[model samples]
Target: MTDASTVIAKPVSQNRAIWQQFRTHRGALFGLIVLGVLAVVVLIGPYLWIPEKLSVAEAIKLKNQGPSWRFPLGTDQLGRDMLARMMLAGRISLAVGLVAMTIAILFGTLIGVLAGYFRRLDGPLMRLTDMFLALPLIPLLLVLVMLFRDRVASIIGPEMGAFALIVFAIGITSWMSTARIVRGEVLTLKEREYVLAARSIGARPHRIILRHILPNVISPVMVSATLEVANAIITESVLSFLGLGFPPDFPTWGRLLFDGLQYMQVYPERVIWPGLAISLTVLSVNYIGDGLRDALDPRIRGR
Candidate 1:
């Protein structure tokens, strides 16, 4: 007896309400705008300046130069244009964040959903997650990178090889938190009336999980994904700073930060450029995640 328009209108109203809630959070709104601008610049800016590719080697005459019309950002110790370095670094940094988060989310969600939905799998899987959680992250990362970096580099080329190893290291390390969160959410959702109803009808476990459980559990997964992006970026930065990440010639924001530290006393702009990019990118992602969390939760959205 319900009208089609009524169903459509309800969803439209909810979407509008969520948008309004997001917009009202001033920090979140600013973050959305800033992130949008950053995405545009990093994705499109490189192509616009065909003469100044981000990967080009340094110009010796421009070495250690300050901000000028020719090089608005400045030149680094190696004479590579700082602006170009930044653009290219952003590409690598952003890619690492996204890809690593995706891998973590996949592993975490699979483990979480299985453990939470099926009682037989809960103890063992959760114990496995805990074991991973207990390991010291930095030491494990160092060991893994040293062990596999050469082999991976040879297979995938140096830049991509390092990239794969770093992403895998991060993905493996970072998924524990997501698994815990998703498991808890699934435990709660699997007990809800709709799930009970689905079970009562003799629905298969897989069908119930796919049709009823996953949709309800997706909000937490999305929030976790946003936070994971920031975590991945910071992890990559740490590796690069330690000289264990990208190839020497291949610049990443973290590598730039490491290189600039020695000259911090002299041209502070060297540090400033890469440092600002990392900070802004991470901060913006965090704020956007905050807004998304509030927007997605009906209880929080109204308040």
Candidate 2:
């Protein structure tokens, strides 16, 4: 169905140009590499280095040990290996960020593009966005968790159920800003010369949006996506800190930090590893987002 030669000749060059553009920003490149490596480590490290000592009994005697050869980041109050727990924690934290971002992006982009492209839906959608913006996010999340946590847990097993509930709550709560950003971009893009050209050729509104509008507005959408991931991660951590998210036995970075707070004076490593992980992850994502914004922007790509 497709001509290999045509793609080989044309698409390769286009991709090369994009890659070159992306590579121009040193910080973005570094962030991309770090993020890629961190993702791999978190996703794979758990399997290769089993955290068999994750259970309570193993840590009972080994508790509160500092960093050493046996336990790289040292043992926690329960003596669980910090290194192993961090890997598994990274898995859950990253998963929450990614899944939540996907839901947010899909809903935000849809609402934004529609509201921006059509006048009929604009007022209602924007009003809804404004209403959400006005609400207190933390309180709203607490209410949702209280109301549906058990119900959701009953529908799905606790692990996945908590995952879905947290992701859904964060995604629903966080889409307003993205929607606004996308709507603003769409409003500008719809007036562009190419969009007008598409209209002159009798293109359907949906087709024009899909083929012309969305592609052009992707830069901002991507920027929003990165920020959304960071936000979701932090929000989940907060939920865990409040004991409303994943179960207590789970090793989320936030939970780890919360657990280690009281022991900070004695065994600081309990807080250090997870805290550093959260800080580094958020910082890397922010840098990557910054790099992406410049690389993906036509105006700045080559500069």
Quantify all predictions' global Cα lDDT against the true fold: 0.88, 0.87
lDDT of 1 by residue, 1-303 (tens): 998766854345777878988888787898889888988888897787443534434466567899998788888886777887788888989999999999999999999999999999999999999999899988899999999999998998998899989999999899998899889999999999999998999999999989988888788898899899999999999999898989878888999988988998899998898889889989998998889888888998763
Pairs of residues at least 3 apart in sequence or in different chains that clash in candidate 1: none
TM-scores, one per candidate: 0.92, 0.90
Candidate 2 ranges with C-alpha deviation above 4 Å: 1-12, 52-58
What digit string (tens of lDDT, one per residue) describes model 2 on residues 78-177? 7778888889999999999999999999999999999999989999999999999999999999999889989988998788888999999999999999
Candidate number achieving the greatest TM-score relative to the actual structure: 1
Lowest lDDT 10-residue stretch of candidate 1: 49-58
Residues forming the 10-long window of minimal summed lDDT in candidate 2: 8-17
Candidate 1: where are CA atoms >4 Å away? 1-12, 50-58
